[model samples]
Target: MNTRWMARSALAFVCCMAANAWADRPATQTERQAMGFDDPAQLVMVRDLPFPADSDTRAPDGAGLGDEWQTRIGTAFQGRTGAFNFGGQAPSIACTSGTERFATATFDLPAGAAIKYVDMFAYDNSSSEEMLVFLLSVCQGTGGADPPVSTILANSTTSGTPGDTVVTLNLSSAPVIVDRYTCRYMVRVNMASPGGTCVGGSIFLDKVRMQYTP
Candidate 1:
């Protein structure tokens, strides 16, 4: 395996370990059941928004990402298949420079579905600097600028390779019950602070999965 793959694998292992540890919690198990979550059928009501395979194709249906509503497909790397940069340039880019560049994608869930968990699988190209945040709601207002952000799924610094960091949020603490036409799940990435080395400066988004029950 290549170095990139090795790094990504190690990161994935760490995430799994963390998830396993969380699974061992009694409160977590009860919450999981209350939300209708099972490892095998966890995604029964999930709605996914994956990056396009390349520039030739368009982002799936309502899925999109960019700083200014631009859909820039990230350049695929050696082992990071189907991975795209959420903010900054692919391969690598100069320091963020403190302007707060970002990449956001939104997914609409079924009407009247109850969301249980929100998970995003992505990472920073460079070291641990970039951050990931989520905003989920039932009735997102009309078109134009981004919606009002309230729920934050993950607000910690990146800690792995460019495509293997998994950020999972348990909505059990604050159950999100959709009563409107549909529930919108949004993933927002805040680029790392500028002035760092060039190699680890971008955020790579691989996939997003939502667990819900209608």
Candidate 2:
């Protein structure tokens, strides 16, 4: 018997056994439903605001420690300006310097739409700074100091050493339900630093889309 032929025969037999094992695995109820999965079409795009270079507004130098920083959203959305701020000294704070700007926006999902996913693209435009962190918050209605229905999806500071450009964030792990009863959802981007001198620069956000998988 040829040694090469014998070796080839053994490999073939092992591959067949592995395939058989995988085919015999049981499927869960959810898996069975997902087998015929067809994602839902997007119903509406309520607010699509771009965080360009001009979107950033400088705050007063050494302003109050706990002040609300906002970016004007023009008359397009009823003269609304997105609100953002640095967290207190306890956990973490937003942009450390005065020139840095944090931007936020709110959008209303359709009346009876189930929000399956949210896709975010952010550009960290800081040449000297190597890293920057941002936060995404989802809430029921748009108002003062309300808790988010889902947990806060905080993205670790991505390396800016490679140069500032758009980076997409996957929201499959943090899906929120937006049905007829739901009112509004908010997305906030802020500088993430515990206690350090904040360097001021610009970050761009674009191509933000939400899909409903009803």
Candidate 3:
């Protein structure tokens, strides 16, 4: 009976140790693959990227009036399909003739976030005017006006004429690191000559996508 009890105790201890070992062990490669899990090293997630901009603030609602970025009105975003100009406008925002007009969308990111790249999916069919996008860091929107403290980070080409084109500001080589107080970014659509040909303006904007790491 004594020998039997000792054998049972040893087996129980071995079982307990095996359970404890696996409790803290990382999943094996085969197990991870069976669960359809991505590699942990490539587990980048989006934190500040806007979801509302997918389809926000249509042309009729005075969506972007005094200030372009309004959090109350559709998550502080604006889009253009070329209504007031050769590109588009935010209803109340000036889509004047002659001078170049811009349809810009703003983004607010956390301090430690990093900007990987921006993709502007656009269609540029206008030979008279142009529609090119730029990613920039501005000091306070118009607040950086007096001297215009602006830095042009990256820009896309204007050759997406008559078809679907994706212009990218890829910085995968070196992502733009940011801080809350020091960095504010925007995607500006340089729409040349607003209101001149409100009817049938050539360039059209499909969407703007920002890929980042937080």
lDDT per residue for candidate 3 within 1-214, as digits (tens), equals 6999999999998996554331122444543332222445422211222223344333343222321211211123343444333324532222334333456777777666666667776656666655556666644433443432344556556663665566766554445666557557777666442222321345556667666666
lDDT of 3 at 148: 27
Top-lDDT structure, candidate number: 3
Tens-place lDDT digits, model 2, residues 1-86: 79999999999989965543311123234322222112222112112122224422223441223322222121111101233333
Model 3 poorest 10 in a row by lDDT: 66-75
What are the per-residue Cα lDDT tens digits for candidate 1 across 125-154? Answer: 565455444433323455635443233332
Give the CA lDDT, 0 to 100, for residue 79 in model 2: 9
Q: List where candidate 1 sits over 4 angstroms from the true fold.
A: 1-100, 138-163, 182-184, 193-202
TM-score of each: 0.42, 0.38, 0.49
lDDT of each: 0.42, 0.37, 0.50
**Residues forming the 10-long window of minimal summed lDDT in candidate 1:** 72-81
Candidate 3 clashing pairs, residues 3+ apart or interchain: 82-87
Candidate ranking under TM-score, highest first, comes to 3, 1, 2
